[model samples]
Target: MRWRARVKQLLLVGIGTAIGFNGVAVAVAPGRMQTAYGIDDPTPDLTVLLRHRAVMLALIGAVVVVSAWRPPLRPTARVVAAVSMTSFVLFAFGTGVNAAQQRVAIADMVLLVALATATALPDEPRPAARP
Candidate 1:
């Protein structure tokens, strides 16, 4: 059980770090992100929207990281992570998966699985045995 909890903590932190890094990249270079995501041409409006999305992603990642230390917030963080990853996966498929999109979708799928596993495990530590 201790190991399981540690694994969950690691996964959550890893996911959070990955997501936060992506968000930072996107925020810093929306045009580059657009190209990387397979968008050939992006308008100013699209760039603005992408920046907003980047902010949201960063916020979510931050929450997930913070929740690692707060048991009560873990459930909410899990739900947010699951929803965000699942939605990205669906959107990637819906839009048609290019090589880059496929890679991102795969990562999102892995994160989804990790979040699910963490959520399924017990958050509280095991009770101590009476001597």
Candidate 2:
């Protein structure tokens, strides 16, 4: 495989780890907001938000893993991964603008940008479609 492909493979692995680990963390420990994120009464909102996040992250991780394992559907998986990354940006940026989640917002922006970039590389065509 080309060096570029290797790089993408590593990036996919990294992002997959990020997504899966973060998913489990948010689900199991949506910790105190005042200390962690500076948000008050974070539990209720965090519950709903983390649940959504966990689902998205789990899906994103699956996409990354699948893409890295095989070229087939990699393009479409990349697009879906990009959408997931973009969704993080949407919430994070909005939180930063209106809700003052500065750190998480910035982090989310950076991670999303990285994931999107990693997934944008060219890949072989997907395997033959089934009926």
Candidate 3:
């Protein structure tokens, strides 16, 4: 594979893993919201919603990671990742994020740039078919 294609794949893998791990952690321990987002005392209803969001994040991350190796899935994965990151960034800004949330927003912005660069890069060349 060409250097650009390799770089793109690597970016997808790294970012996907980071996102997935975070989701899993939060899913396993919903209390993380208190520390991560400064939620002092979340109601039971809030906990359920947060856990659901964590699952969605994990699914999004899985799609992104799979797309790294499956070119055919790239378009959908890109859309998923873009929407996930864009929504969080917009919501954070719109609602006035706390310090921890601000950090997450910044990281999401950086990841968005990386995702854009990967998308802009040339795709890998396919092998010639046999006669």
Candidate 4:
């Protein structure tokens, strides 16, 4: 039980941090993000769109991080994380696999597995009642 809790905590924090950092990077430096993602034809309109997507990703990350210790929010956080990660994974694959794209897809795949495992674990046991 202790180990389960620790695993859950670690997954939540790690996934949230990774996602949030990516969001910040995309939002703050779209050109750099494009380069990193192997995008070569970035326009002003695309940058705005990417920034908006980054905001959404950042919000999701924030929710996951905050919900880690909040039992009430756990289910929703897990659901959102699963959906977002799954979507990203699918998108990465659909975009076709160059070396760079394969790296992104693989990372997302690992994150998705971690999120699923964390979500599947039973909730923490409540404290015993007084006599």
Give the winner by lDDT. 3
lDDT of each: 0.81, 0.66, 0.86, 0.79
Q: Could you tell me the TM-score of candidate 4?
A: 0.86
TM-scores vs. true structure, each candidate: 0.85, 0.66, 0.94, 0.86
Residue range with the least summed lDDT across 10 consecutive positions in model 2: 31-40
Q: Per-residue lDDT for 12-123 in model 4, tens only?
A: 8888877777787888888665554666777888778878888888888888888778868888988887788888778878877566667766877888888888888777
* Candidate 3 TM-score, true structure as reference: 0.94
- After superposing candidate 1 on the true structure, give the runs of residues whose Cα lies further than 4 Å from its correct spot: 34-36, 126-131
lDDT of 3 by residue, 6-89 (tens): 898999997787677778777899879877667768899988888888888888899899999999988998898989999999
- How many steric overlaps are in each model, in order? 0, 0, 0, 0
Worst lDDT run of 10 residues, candidate 1, spans 31-40
lDDT of 1 by residue, 53-99 (tens): 88888888988988877778887888888889899999988988788
Per-residue lDDT of model 2, residues 1-131, tens digit only: 36767777787777677656666565666663343355566567667886577667777777777778777756776677667767766776765543445665566666667677776765545569899
Tell me which of candidates 1 and 3 scores higher on lDDT: 3
- Give residue 114's lDDT in candidate 2 (0 to 100): 69
Looking at model 4, which ten-residue stretch has the lowest summed lDDT? 31-40
Name the better of 1 and 3 by TM-score: 3
Question: Residue 72 lDDT in model 3?
Answer: 93
